[model samples]
Target: MRIIKAAVLVAAGAMLSWTPARADTVPEFRGNDTGGIIAYELAHRVDARQLAVDHCASYGKVAKFLAVDAQYGGYVSFACRWVPYGASNQPLRTLY
Candidate 1:
């Protein structure tokens, strides 16, 4: 009986740990413009940069992705810099 109880407890603990937490709010990309650069945060690096560029478009500016990072649980932060029309810019590269 003790062995069965211990096994059940372990299984219960495992199930609980495996369950994902319910997020109260939806995760969203956030951004800000600083010195002609759009800084952003999101769950994924690619999406973060896209968001920054989109934001720059809203401000009537063209952007090129600069730096990105995704180190903690899909939480990413990135920056986009303005580029002149017809000028080439480096592709987006995630640091991690």
Candidate 2:
């Protein structure tokens, strides 16, 4: 029947036009030797900080928090600085 064929076409069109929703829950790091920025959701702040620390560690430095922006989900700015004497390059871990 023409009605059935029209219904099928409409369904197919809708299916073709469907788009999946996107939530940026993953932390993204962008930095260089001097400093870097991390974009992430609030729930992923810890992950972002850890990523910064790891990146700075690669350069034999430590990560220092500079600023935070809550717009566009969230962002954390950090600078890589030399590790002072008697200071550990590793981030402090809490045992729960």
The window of 10 residues in a row where model 2 has the poorest summed lDDT is: 87-96
Per-residue lDDT of model 2, residues 1-83, tens digit only: 99999999999989977965565445476789888988756426457767777878777778899999877766789999887
lDDT at position 8, candidate 1? 100
Whole-model alpha-carbon lDDT for candidate 2: 0.75
What TM-score, computed on C-alpha atoms, does each candidate reach?
0.35, 0.54
Give residue 66's lDDT in candidate 2 (0 to 100). 92
lDDT of each: 0.53, 0.75
Query: How many backbone collisions does model 2 have?
Result: 0
Candidate 1: lDDT of 37? 31
The clash numbers for all candidates, in the given order, read: 0, 0
Instruction: Pick the lDDT winner.
Output: 2
Off by over 4 Å in 2: 1-27, 42-46, 86-96
Cα RMSD of all models vs. native, in order, equals: 11.3, 6.8
TM-score of model 1 (CA atoms):
0.35
